[model samples]
Target: MKNTFEELKIAKSILKSLDDIGFKVPTPIQQKAIPKINSGGNLVGIAQTGTGKTAAYLLPLLTRLQKPEGNDPRVVILVPTRELAIQVGEDIAELTTYSELRHAAVFGGIGWTKHAELVEPGIDIIVATPGRLWDLYQEGVLRLKKVKHLVIDEADRMLDMGFMPQLKQLQEIIPARRQNLLFSATFSPAIEKLAEEFLDFYDKLEVAPSATTVSQVTQTAYKVPNYRTKLNLIRYLLEDEEKFTRVVIFVKTKEHAEGVFKVIQRKAEGEKRILHSNKAQNTRINAIQAFKSGDVRILITTDVSARGMDVSMVSHVINFDLPRDYDDYVHRIGRTARAGNKGDAITLIDPADEWHWKNILKLIRKDIELLPLPEEVEVLETEFGENQDQLREIDRQRKIDDPTFQGAFHQKKRKGSNKRSFDDKFSRSKERQKRKKRRKL
Candidate 1:
């Protein structure tokens, strides 16, 4: 087995760029994937996030497209989110520093005309989101005839975001003879179906099992009472600035993201930023940049917003709210413990989130340590509405497990209670009749 990039038969110019960027050895995924991709066959790579999956595909594709070709792109990389598109584009830019390979990263939120202008000059590689790519193609500004390499990065995420329709449309448009490369963090049955649709006859390469957490990360959970208490716990943990220096807090909803960011902004020691779908594209980009450069110590983001952020040296990842999608827990934690660096993942599990947390455990197939609430952190009483919401969620989970089981909130009233109500109504009607008769007499 080849261990180094050079032994893998990488081009000297690309190797020089890699060395300059401090890439010493190929990651396991890279070691296995680079060869298969270079073989010029369709390939499906299953690896967890933060495992250099991007480079595994990019290095070989870049090698194949060493120089600029036709006016249209020879390589089309499809990412699930704008963040991922930008990140992949940046990687390409860095890797091709010693070569002449023009590329463009096009996505939504910016004008399609701007992207058209970008590709009008001619591009060898085009990294784009599905929606934006389709728009450009439809506008006749971008052509697909010369696209020989079609890469679907984060296939699972694409499905989650409902990009299958666009992907299917793209499949019909792109030449059938093109090589397909699909990279996903998890290889579930859905991904298998996706592979069948996209890849003709591809080789499968898996570095790790699907939904597996990074081994270097220390996983721990805190059983909190409610959201307010979770905030208090976060404040308590952030008191240790040295330990929680660089943190990414993942929340389930934009509201939660905002709430957490506000709390951290006032209570936490260092700089903090918030990211969600509501934020402007430029704002989101700048926030990611700041977090990546270590200018910001903390980033509070929703799962959607943080999908493709590739930041190194993240000391900790805090799950402010457990993600509804079980696989997302794996992705959220993978944000830390990257590049062989040890990191910590802390999850705050409230009553409602515990069910999802348990499902996450089952998905990862591991036992996570549940830490007791810290002494300094005050566990506030659960609000009435919050308690009701927790109960409702629990009831929903129960119904999912047993379809016959009626939930507490929607349970039918007892026969005796119905009878009593009926009798009381009858008695009230009789009394009203008696009062009317007395008035008449």
Candidate 2:
């Protein structure tokens, strides 16, 4: 008997391309998704990174594209980041190499005229970031009416970046009859609401256990005293006599990303690079490619690369700063242990971060043994109250001199009293009006 995708009855040419790409058997996600996709149902594929999800949706869409019915772009894929856009575009290109169907990538980092030129002949598929695509749509350079398929990849990230408004606007502009496919590494309840808003009567496809970390990765954590101590621990970890050829360290903020990059550059006698939203687009792309090519030993990046990164040989992933969200923790660890290779992930957790640490353990449903701090370094109970003393002093000064806080607090109380007083007066006025009416009667 034929497989699920084959049973979906894809076109011969598309099947030929799939076979050429060495895709005989579909992954669990593809297995579950292809059949439903062939049935023309809106699909929400919720699986972790590296689950062959790109092919799951691409193959089904390509099957329909090979039969060519209308002109303007037929498939539209929206991604959160430029790197993801490029990755999706490459995947589409690989699947359609033998076919005449064209694919165009639209993102902010490159010149729009180049993208405009590519879009001139129109395309079978357009993979883009929400902001750039929204700009083009508003400028009248792109048309969504001819779009037959709409795919929103990384719905949670897109929502986190505040693209819901743009997505709703795009939905209003695009034809209502298009097939919708929403894919993400994790499907939280918030993502579910987005799927409902975007897709009608969609079939949900989940490839792995929700909110679960990759089994192939070894997860470990260390408790540090403070941010500076965490940095020292990262330096110590990277300098281990047993070194990894390629390592990606995830930081929580843009400043921290640059700071880590500097520290690695100064301390390591090896190559390193920095990637964050603050960097130019080309710089970010080149950094990713360089790291993938093993040209860069260490890549310091913010959460931008924690999701949708496809590098297979990443040997180690270090979380210099533990992410507050458990889902983010899962995505951060996913960067490593990909393509059937074993990888290691280590995190530095400060006492202040225990709240997030607790949430993470709850999400993973496992006990994460906390590694002892380096003996040379000192460890102490993180002072939650001491850290806020500076802010408290500032508030005190404001109350003594500026009077802004005290005035605001008193003004709020006065406003509340006035509101209550107005309500009483209004009630008395209404009662007087009722009595006057009764007297007249």
Candidate 3:
């Protein structure tokens, strides 16, 4: 087993770039993957986020990237989101700093005219999202016949976001002879099925068990009463500026992302930013860049949007809301505890999140430590409106899982309401007849 980057037979220029970036040792993923990737074969890498999975493939590919020949890309990397495309493009630039490799990243939000100009001359490598890539290909701006390498990064995430159709389309369009590499955090049945359909015969590389989180992260969950109380807890925790210096708070929805940011804006005492689908592309990129440069202490984001961000040395990852999708918990926590650095993951769970919380425990195959609420963190009473909203969502989820499941928020009807229920059909008819008789008199 090669233990260091030097033992992996990387090119001098790439090695020089890595050394300049202070990458002394190869991570577990890199150690297990680089050798095979350096040689020629289709590969499937099963590893979580922050496992240096990007470098595992990028290094070897960068070494293989020769000078551009024609008006076409030699390699195409498909990511799940635009944020990831930008981050991967940045990584490629850093990795090829000492080399002469040319790359471009094309995603939505920016005008296609700009990307059209970018790929007009030619590109060595292209990192893009499925929709944007398809759009460019349809516009005759992207040529894949010259593509010698095809990489589907964050395969699980791509499939979750319904990119399988686009992937199948690209698979049919790109040259049939290129090497394929699919990287994923977990190999669930669905992901495995995707691998079987999408990838040719390939070597498998796994650094850890599926759904395994970073060992360096200390995991803890706080049982809060409601969303307002979760904010109170966040306020209490952020008071320790030294401990919570660099944080990524993960929420489930755009509304929650905005809500959390607003509260922390007035209450917390540090620079903060929010990233969500509703935000403009430049805005999201700027927020992430600011957080990466240490200009901001906190970044609140949704799971899908944060998948591509690779900020190092994150002090902590706080789950402002437990993910309904259990696998996201792993991705969220993986943001911290990176590169053998110890960090913490704090999860706030409300009554509505109990079902999702249990699923998370089952996914990780263990129970997390429960942290008692601090004295300063006052648990606020859940307001009636908020409680009903939560109950409605919970009931909706339960019905999907179990059709017979009856929940607390079951629909009820008032007698005087205009809309009549099946049980009130006769009463409504009688009321109408009484009104008609009075009118006739």
Instruction: Point out where model 3 deviates above 4 Å.
Output: 392-441
**For residues 93-189, could you state the per-residue lDDT of candidate 1 as single tens digits?**
9999999989999999989999999999999999999999999999999999998999999999999999999999999999999989999889989
TM-score of each candidate? 0.94, 0.82, 0.90
Best of the candidates, TM-score: 1
Q: TM-score of model 2 relative to the true fold?
A: 0.82
Q: Which stretches of candidate 2 lie over 4 Å from their true place?
A: 1-24, 67-71, 241-243, 374-441
lDDT of 3: 0.89
- Least well predicted 10-residue stretch by lDDT in candidate 1: 411-420
How far off is residue 235 in model 1, in Å? 0.3
1-441 in candidate 3: lDDT tens per residue? 998777898888989998899999999999989888878888999999988999999988887875556779999999999989999999999988888878999898887889988888888999999988988999998888899899999998998899989999988999999898999999899888888886769888889989988888899999998989999899889989989999999998999988888888978878999888888888989999999899999999998889788888899999998887788888899999887788999999887788788888888887799989999988789999988888888898799899988888767676668866777888888899999999999
Ranking by lDDT: 1, 3, 2
Which candidate number maximizes lDDT? 1
